[model samples]
Structures are given as structure tokens and as C-alpha cells.
Target: EPEVTQTPSHQVTQMGQEVILRCVPISNHLYFYWYRQILGQKVEFLVSFYNNEISEKSEIFDDQFSVERPDGSNFTLKIRSTKLEDSAMYFCASSLLPTGSEAFFGQGTRLTVV
Candidate 1:
């Protein structure tokens, strides 16, 4: 089965720096999303994209965060500046439908901002 793949399973960066987390979602899926878990916290939705546009986004996805589908097969999340509180396990997910469907998630990129 096809699955989402993320680069650099673990990333360590200094505060105030920038980081771009890359992902390759399932090819046939129509909806893509970015989610994050801050250590022991529950998964929080960051943003959702469809048709190459942002369909939805949470307050957490402020001006500092951006998502892009640079190509047909790649989806990426970029944090313009890193903060200590931004450390978390960021997950990339995709679903065939907008709702009521299973979303496949990648192993996640563990981002640690020092």
C-alpha cells in the first residue's frame, strides 16, 4: 500500500532559525494535512490543503507557518522561525476524501528546537 514519507526522522535546530519539514503524501489522495503533537499533548491540526490551496488552518498556523505543494508528489511544511515551544512530532497525512474517510499518516518528523 502507498504511504506518506517524511524526510529527516529527527531534526534539531536552534531557536529563531528556520526549518522546512518535507513530506510525500499518497499520490491518489485528494486532501493533505499537517498535524503536530507537542510531547504528551494530543494531536493538533495545523493546516489542510486541497487543489493546491489552503482549505483550512488553525490559529497555530500563524504567519510563521506555510505549506506548499511544490510538485504533484510533494507536500511541505515550513516554519519560518523556530521556537522552543515549537518542538514536537509533526505528522503529514492524506485522505482520499474531505471527510468520513481514513487518513494515512507518516511516521512523523520529530522537530526539536533548542
Candidate 2:
């Protein structure tokens, strides 16, 4: 079965630097999303993309965060001006339907802000 794949399983960056996390969702899935889990916290929704545009976003996805489907198969999340609180395991997910369906998730990219 095809699955979401994320690059650089572990990423370490300076507090003021920028980071771009990448993901390749399942080839046939139509909806894609970015979610993050702070060390011991619950998974939080960041944003969702469909039809090459942002479909939904949470407050957590402020100006500092952006998501893009730069091509037919790649989805990416960029965090500008990383902060200590930004350290977390960011997960990439895709689903055939926006709701009432299972969403496949990647292993996740652990972002560590120093």
C-alpha cells in the first residue's frame, strides 16, 4: 500500500531560523493536511489543502506557517522564524475524502528548535 513519506525524520534548527518540512502523500488521495503534536500533547490540526488551495486552517497555523502543493505529488509546510515552542512532531496526512474516511499519516518530521 502506498503511504505518506516525509523527509528528514529529524530536523534541528536555530530559534530564529526557518524550516521547510516536506511530504509526499498517497498518489490518489485528494485531500492533504498538516498536524502537529507537542511532546506530550494532543494532535493539533494546522491546515488542510485541496484542489491546490487551502481548504481549512486552525488558529495555530498563523502567519508563520504555510502549506503548499508545489507539484502534482508533493506537499510541504514551511515554518518561518522558528521558536522553542515550535518543537514538535509534525505529521502529514492524506485522505480520499475530506470526512468520513481514514486518513493515512506519515511517520512524521520531528522539528527541534534550539
Candidate 3:
């Protein structure tokens, strides 16, 4: 069995700086997504991608955020300017099934902005 993997398990950045979190999803999955969990909050969806285009995105994925599949095997999420509020654990997930199906998720990239 394969799993989604994210690089830089933990990161600390200064406010206003840029950060790009990287992920490699399960090879057979077709849909990819980015979600975030604040220190003690529930996970929230940020964006979803399918067939190389964005299928859906939440308000959190605003002008300050962007996601891309630069190559066939990797996906990345970038925050143009980090904010203290952006501190959270970001998870990358992928699914072979439909929208609500269970997906494989990465360990998460913890981002702390100060």
C-alpha cells in the first residue's frame, strides 16, 4: 500500500515570507487536496484538484495561497506571505474514489509563522 508523503515535516517562518510545502501522493489516486488543522482545531479543506485543474477551493485558498502540480508525480502548496494566523498542520491527501471517499493523507507539514 502506498501513502501520500510531504516534505519538511515541520517549518517555522517569519511573517511576510513565502513557503512552499511539497507532497507526493499515492500513485494510483486521481484526486488531490490540501487541508489544514490549526493547533487545536478541526481540519478544514483549502483546495481540491483533479485532472490537473482545480475542482474546488475554499475561501482559505485566497490570493495569498496557490497550489500546483508542476510534474506528474508531485503537488505543491505555496503561501505567498505567511501570517501568524497561517500557523497550522497542513495535510496533503489523495483518493482513487469520488469526492467523499476515504483518502490517503500525508503525515502533515507543520507551519508556524511568527
Candidate lDDT values, in order: 0.97, 0.97, 0.95
Segments of candidate 2 deviating more than 4 angstroms: none
For candidate 1, the per-residue lDDT at 2 reads 94
Which regions of candidate 3 are displaced past 4 Å? none
- Encode model 3's per-residue lDDT on 1-114: one tens digit a residue: 688999999999999999999999999899999999998899999999999889999989999999999999999999999999999999999999756788889999999999
Query: Which candidate would rank higher by TM-score, 2 or 3?
Result: 2
Instruction: Score residue 91 of candidate 3 by CA lDDT.
Output: 99
Q: What tens-digit string does per-residue lDDT give for candidate 2 at 34-95?
A: 99999999999999999999999999999999999999999999998999999999999999
Worst 10 residues of 2 by lDDT: 65-74
True-structure lDDT of candidate 2? 0.97
lDDT of 2 at 7: 92
Taking every candidate in turn, the Cα RMSD to the unseen true structure, in Å, is 0.5, 0.5, 0.9
Q: Estimate, for each residue in 1-114, the C-alpha lDDT of model 1 and write its tens digit.
A: 899999879999999999999999999999999999999899999999999999999999999999999999999999999999999999999999999999999999999999
Mind sharing the TM-score for model 2?
0.98
Provide the TM-score for each candidate, comma-separated: 0.98, 0.98, 0.96
